[model samples]
Target: MSGRSVKKGKRPQNSGNVLAVETKTTTTAQNNVKFCLNHMQSGFSVEDLSKEARAEFAMALFKRRGMTWTEIQQAPKHGLGSEKMPASSIRAAIPRVFGDVENFLVLRYSGLLPMAGVRVGDVYHIVWLEPQFGDLYDHG
Candidate 1:
C-alpha cells in the first residue's frame, strides 16, 4: 500500500514470474495403403465389374488396409503385387496432367482385376480398373 499505490479504477499489476512452455511437434508416418478413383475414366465404371469381382476388390482393399506398400511389394503370393508399368505401354490413355508420368503403379487386386494408377504419398490415385485382366496392361 505504501509502495506504488494503485489509482482508482486501475487494475493491479501482474507479478514478473513468466513461464516459457516448449512445444515439440511430431509427424506420424503413413504406413497404411489408401486408394482413390480420381483418374478413372467414365468409360471404366464400377458397374462393369462383376458382382464377384466387386466383392473381391472390396475384400482385397479390406485385407490390405493394414499393409504397407513395402509389404505389398514383398509378397507376391497375395497377388497384390505393386509393379510399375511404362506409361506408354498402358492400354488406357493417361490423363493429360500425367502426360509426363514415366510409369503407373499397377496393383492386381484379384486374379483378373488389375488396378492402374499413380501413387502420391500413400494414396493410390486409381486411373483404370480392368476386370478382364490384361485390358489395362499386358501381363506378359
Candidate 2:
C-alpha cells in the first residue's frame, strides 16, 4: 500500500460551506424617532440601555437627529477622541428611551452581559420593536 492515507468524505472544519448565523433585530423608522425623542426628553445615555438595545437605540438617536453614518462614526459622544463610555452606562440608559421590556428582551437575545465600553454595532438594529402609539397597545 502507498505511504499516504486517503481522507474520508467529511468536509474540513471552518469551510466556506459552513454557515454562521448572525441575527440582528431593529425598530421601525417612526418608532426610532419616538424613542430618540423620549431619550432626549428624559436625558437618556448609553449607560441607560441594555447591551443588545444600545446599538439600535443609538441608531435611532442618530436617525432622529438626522445624522449621517459618517457623522455617527466621527461623533464626539461615541468617544472617538476621548475615554469610551461603559456598556453598563449604555444599558442603564436604554430604559429611558425604549422603556424596560424591549431593552430587557434585546439584551437577553443578544447574549451580552453588563460591562463597560461595548461596541454599538455588535448589539441591535433600528427595527426590532414596533413603535407604541398612545393607548393602542395599552390594556390599561
Candidate 3:
C-alpha cells in the first residue's frame, strides 16, 4: 500500500521501474523505527552523524544487543568512555533497572563512538554519538 495501490496479484513483472517503485528499502524510506531506543534524551542530535555513522549506528545497536559486555569489549575497535550527566531528569528517565546513571558504555564503529548507556539488565538505551577522538569529555 506504499506506492500506487495495486491488487495483491497485480504487481508488475520484473522491471527496473517496478522494482524502484515497489521495493524501495532505504533505512529512512522503509522503516522509521529507530535502532537507539531512548538515547536521544542524552543530549545530542541524530543529524550530527554523517551518513556512514548513521549506518554504523544501526550496526552497533544490532551487535550490542546480542554480545555480552565481555564479548563486545574484546574487539580492538571498541573502547570505554563516559559522560557526566548529573541531572536528575536524566536519571529519572531511565528505568530503575539501569543501576546507576554515573556513566555509560561506548560502542565504537566507523569512527563513531555511540553511547550504550548504563545498562544493568539487558536492552540498552543508546544516546548520542561522537566522532572519533582521543578521549571523550563532556563540555557542559
**All predictions: root-mean-square deviation over Cα?**
11.4, 15.5, 11.9
**Tens digit of lDDT per residue, candidate 3, span 23-138?**
34443222222244554543333466668777876675565445554454455544432233443433224445554566565455555454445444333455545543432334
Q: Candidate 1 vs candidate 3: which has greater lDDT?
A: 1
Question: What is candidate 2's local distance difference test score?
Answer: 0.31
Q: Which segments of candidate 1 are over 4 A away from where they belong?
A: 1-30
* lDDT-superior candidate, 1 or 2: 1
Count of backbone clashes for each model?
0, 25, 2
Which digits, one per residue and each the tens of the lDDT, describe model 2 over residues 8-62?
Answer: 8987456454323323453232121112121231323354455656775454444
Top candidate (lDDT): 1
TM-score-wise, the better of 2 and 3 is: 3
On TM-score, the leading prediction is 1
Quick one: ranking by lDDT, best first? 1, 3, 2
When sorted by TM-score, best at the front, the candidate numbers are 1, 3, 2
